[model samples]
Target: MFEQFTQDARQTVVLAQSAARRLGHHYIGTEHLLLGLLSQPHTLAARLLVVRGLDLAYAETTVLRLLGTPGLDARDADALGTIGIDLSAIKEKVEATFGRGALDRDPAHTRAGRFAGGGHIPFTKRAKKVLELSLREALRLKHKHIADGHLLLGLLREGEGLAAKVLAEAGIDFAQLRADLDRDIPAVPA
Candidate 1:
């Protein structure tokens, strides 16, 4: 799936991962992807988003505010466990720095994303779905490969995700955004 992504698009994903890591998030989410798109000034997606008044700082502020202070949720802990990570050690480390009961007091707030950096961060379910839908959008448009614009389309189509909500709150209409893209950005044939 990654092989078909354009160079800029691929870079956007890396930027997304970095954004998630920088935010201390243990999982990559659509909000991270939004940051990724906004990070690259040269991509069509970035241009489009910026034209609509979206930028990295605004996106970061909105996403962080929306997500709230998250701790390790059960599903995320289970996911980590499946990958052979010992949650107890992680909790101990967190507690050592932030003091006791830090990891458990709000254990259900997995979105807190404080365990980022070092080692691989996994994609959240919605993040994976966004990537899949990005590819699908590219294919549906008969494009040879997925690009940042396709990623924007995927975020729009996945309307229930945080990124979509943020976009909506920022006054972006997905349908019009798609229409504008179709009008301005030509999809290259395979």
Candidate 2:
């Protein structure tokens, strides 16, 4: 199935893995795949998302907040605030003590190094489903290869992944995006 993916699609998957690692996640999820799509600025999917104000950083922060990453969520901030603890101050102190982005770094992965010796970060079930659905979207569109747009279509069609949730929270109209994507997909000559 991956063999039918275009270079951009394959790169999206690779970038998804990187997103997972960067977020200190043990597995690649639909949210990571969404970040992957946003990372490729020139892709049709990225362009559409950016037009909707869904940039990579915002998506990444949303993913982390939704997944309940340590010290990254608003709820965590509120809780700390109640206790008279400033999360931002803590973050600043940590960064001052340990260099920038100390909180973002995964110590285990950092010791082993990026993309190295981390064993392998497997995809979550929903993420695998999105990939499968990407193929289905390509077939539905009568395309020979799955591209990044197809991947985004799959995320939309899945409708319940974290990516979908982020899109919803970002006020994206899924139906409209789906229509635009269906129209924008590059056609192959018969």
**TM-score of every prediction relative to native:** 0.74, 0.80
Q: How close is candidate 2 to the true structure, as a TM-score?
A: 0.80
Residues 1-190, candidate 2: write the lDDT tens digits. 8898888899999999877765556678999899999999999999999999999989988876776646468888999899999998988798788654457766776687643335578899999999999999999998999999999999999999899999999999999999999999897521
List the global CA lDDT of all models: 0.79, 0.87
Please, what are the lDDT tens digits per residue for candidate 1 over residues 90-143?
877986886544543333344453443345667889988999999888878888
Best by TM-score: 2
- Give the poorly placed runs of model 1, Cα more than 4 Å off: 71-116
lDDT of 1 at 122: 76
Alpha-carbon lDDT of model 2: 0.87
Would you give me the overall lDDT of model 1? 0.79
